[model samples]
Target chain A: MRDGKDDAAPRARRRFLKLAGLGTAASGAALLAGSGAAKAAAPAATEAAKGYRVTDHVRRVYDLARF
Target chain B: MIAPEDQGRAYLYRLLARLLAAAPDAATLGLLRGLGGDGSPVGGDLQGLAGAAATAGPGALEREYHDLFIGVGRGELVPFGSWYLAGFLHEKPLAHLRRDLGTLGLGRTAGTKEPEDHVASLCEAMALLIEGKGDLGAQKAFFERHLEGWAPAFFADLERARAARFYAAVGRLGARLMTLERDGFAFVEGVAA
Candidate 1:
């Protein structure tokens, strides 16, 4: 049951996403290739293991939002 | 294994998180200017962003960002999930999100006063989930609990906000992506059911 549902569900979801332009050159991969934005936020698990540290990008956001 | 298509989703989420986190610097703007998209709605919004980035100047962009997100007291739009869902900052929604994040082995970086439910943080969290830190079930649960309720409305508001220029494009793209994710998840659920 798990294997069957996983196969059908992911395929259907992937098809839907593709139709909606996700992961396509128009929407995802090509557009993000040169941008450093993708690396701006460290994953929570990684950050947790390494100790809590916000990147400069995230720090800047905090600074901007400070009242 | 993470699929290439899922990588795109992570990339989109990270880009949105970055943009919402702060105004774009010169390098970011340059990247945005070079972005190309196909004819889909999401693609059209990307094109719109590229156009906006091409024409935007640093000074004006700074002012626009400030006006839209971080004015003297508060900006025109509050980008926190708590505010959107609970009519205030640091409300129950934030507490719930914090509890959820802890369960996922995630926590806010020390010394950051912003709540976990800030739009940027939520987007970043979603990116992490998609990037393989969390399973599909986790991603679905996170989106449904924290973002699905209010993020679409926030993005729609950002698109039409008076001070939005480049960010209007960001907003449009965000709105479209959220819709796609919501529908995509539903499709999966329907199949599973």
Candidate 2:
């Protein structure tokens, strides 16, 4: 009506395109945020790895078993 | 393919194998201490292991491991499949295990002098198998051929060994896990049949 066209096809196509574009942009933002969170979580995992290691105490036990 | 739920079983077997292999450090001890305890038998054993680690400390655990597994000449227990199956290490059982392991395309880790039949190593192999290297059929075959014959008895012996303290709890956990693995395998076989 605003464009002086009684047929609604062009207006509907415009709305559909706008919605699809918004959906894609929102998903892209979510993907970026997800990757950032994954990166932040990775170092904590490596820190947990440091908790278990071959220490002098373990070596001494290994030495005793040497026969 | 390994169902997603089966991964937990593989992880538990691996954990038990590692705990049995060496004394946990202070950090490792703390992680064990943090596990939630409940009324289940496995939970009780885990709590017992945690308590032992908290009370004894890493130094004491190291000494205990040395005494119980690495005595002057021989430890109080022999953690070997061959011994458990045939009254001696490197016997027919060990040979059979080696053949099966070869068929499975697994081998001992490099630089490790321990025999292939070591209980810890077998558990590790099963963990790998269940983690996707082998399917359910392969898992059942390996367990029946290698583990089911002797590991339960070995765990029972470990639970009763005079030198056991923290390891006794480990023994209990291992015993429970073995039972679960056995039952799981049987259930799968039953479904197939």
Candidate 3:
């Protein structure tokens, strides 16, 4: 797992994770990718707590989720 | 790597910045030199030291930056995702990450040429995700698959890199975050598994 290679305990574990819901096979992640620098950042200290603006891929995932 | 989904949180950025900047002696150790703070070993370490090579006095730090990050040849750690993950640099991880980005509705800025795997970029992404700046589930997935695996090792090297001084602290901070992320993810997995 740490080596990024597949082994027994971890590999099997990872496989199980995939079999479960966590092993989400990511599709094309390039859709909304943007330069993070220009994206307006919510002021660090602000109380409003604005979001960092997610990509459409995330929205898709959210749509898929039963949660 | 603290669950990239949570990276958008201000706490994450502050932790990262603190990791980058040696937690000034006071906050770190509790020994306040002028204030009589924690007084840990790191507390008094960097005080006598100079600035970061890239942005030192009279642009010394900038010079160091050229030396460290923007040298004509190559920089210290090669802060790219491909380099870190694939070892040879620009391998499947980068392609995978890019694909993930596309699906997520995120786009790379036209101006900055650095690949998506840059540490700053990763951290920025996480920070955005954390503040609910993006979809929590999507951000979490991005962070879990790509970063949680490799970043800790990268930060470990950064801390111990021969040229490390100021960035040594950055390394430590990163190392700590790595621990947090690893354990945190494991905990989450523990539940799902």
Assess each prediction's global lDDT (C-alpha) against the native. Answer: 0.73, 0.59, 0.43
Total clashing pairs for each candidate: 2, 0, 56
- lDDT (Cα, tens digit) per residue for candidate 3, span A1-67: 1313433544453343333212121101111112233234333311111122212212322332322
Ten-residue stretch with the least lDDT total in model 1 chain A: A48-57
Per-prediction fnat: 0.31, 0.00, 0.00
TM-score of chain A of each: 0.34, 0.24, 0.30
> Who is ahead in lDDT, 1 or 3?
1
Task: Name the candidate that leads on TM-score.
Answer: 1
Query: Model 1 Cα displacement at B88 (Å)?
Result: 0.4
User: Model 3 scores what on Cα lDDT?
Assistant: 0.43
DockQ-based class of model 1: acceptable
Fnat of candidate 3: 0.00
Which is superior by TM-score, 2 or 3? 2
Candidate 2, position A64, lDDT: 41
User: What is the C-alpha lDDT profile of model 1 across B1-193, one tens digit per residue?
Assistant: 6665677777778778767776787877888888887886667788898899999987888788888877765578877888789876657888889998898877866665556776877887888887666877778878889999999999999999999989999999899889888887875442221
RMSD versus native structure for model 1: 4.8
- For candidate 3, what is the DockQ? 0.03
**lDDT digits (tens) for residues B18-108 of candidate 3:** 3332223322222111211123222222221212322334244334434454345455656555666666544688788878766754556
State the weakest 10-residue window (summed lDDT) of model 2 chain B.
B184-193
Candidate 3 displacement at residue A52 in angstroms = 20
Docking class of 3: incorrect
Full candidate order by TM-score, most accurate first:
1, 2, 3
